[model samples]
Target: MRHGVQLLLVFLVLVLAVPASVSASSEGGHGGGDSKKKEKSEKKEKGDKKEAGKAENGVITIGPLVVNILSNKGYRFLRLEMIVECADNEAAERLVKADAKEELILMLSNKVADNLLANSGKMILRKELIDLFSKYTGPDKVKNLYFAEFVFQ
Candidate 1:
């Protein structure tokens, strides 16, 4: 509470100081002298916003999910990571909030090492996982899926 009040006071001081400085600078023609600087600042701010927008629409990783799967010899370790391309950022966030990691763990645990290590098996697993996650992302909301990491031991 004390820190909050101090921060508020500092904010108020800065706010009150800015307009006074601006008015004084304009009166002295100093503000006009710094027009280019202001333009640069504005451009920098716009660039920052564009970067943020791209981040929102960027790739979202499901998990570096580590699970145990059944094998002919015994239980084996499976470490998998996936990224899903979504129709929109909101759909991507939904996939995360939908608790898909737990579902993936269960799905992976039922697999065998031989199937996972094989190309056909990996493709099948990818399709099944996509279909499972599509429940949360909505129909055709998932644009694509990519395996960032897949390790079976």
Candidate 2:
């Protein structure tokens, strides 16, 4: 009886250990194939990032800008909300460190006012505003601009 019990234990240990060794060897053989799949996925991720135009670091949403408009009849106003996409983490940090919110407000306000005055109260188009800001900030530095809210009064 003692001899039979010892044999059963040995057999169970071998059965457990054999499958683990087989799986480990199989995994090692397949390791080389994973590199190609990894490379393809990495390439796909790069392409997706470019197409999305997402900031590598993040994005900044700048304000509900309230500007008084120049109108012939009465006091007109323009309110706008804008999102600024920075080139990367460094650029976004620079923007905050420079205290550019006020400066940006002034510059953007001037641009909008200039358009309104030139057209005699014709509001500026979203695309034109984006282009103007891109020019001001340098297209390389600012990835893109988005209008979250726009109201003319």
In candidate 2, residue 140 scores what lDDT?
Answer: 73
Best by the lDDT measure: 1
Candidate 2 lDDT, 13-128, residue by residue in tens: 99999976676557565555567668999999987654222234547555566876555555467787766677765554444333455555555555444455443444345555
lDDT for model 2:
0.60
Compose the digit string of candidate 1's lDDT tens values, residues 1-153: 999999999999999999878875775565664676788899999876543213156357766778989999999998888878888887777766537766768878998898777789899988998898788878988888899999877
The models' CA-based lDDT, in order, is: 0.79, 0.60
The Cα RMSD of model 1 versus the native structure comes to 11.6
Q: Candidate 1's error at 39, in angstroms?
A: 26
TM-score of model number 1: 0.61
RMSD values for the candidates in order, in angstroms, are 11.6, 12.8
Question: Which stretches of candidate 1 lie above 4 Å from their native place?
Answer: 1-55
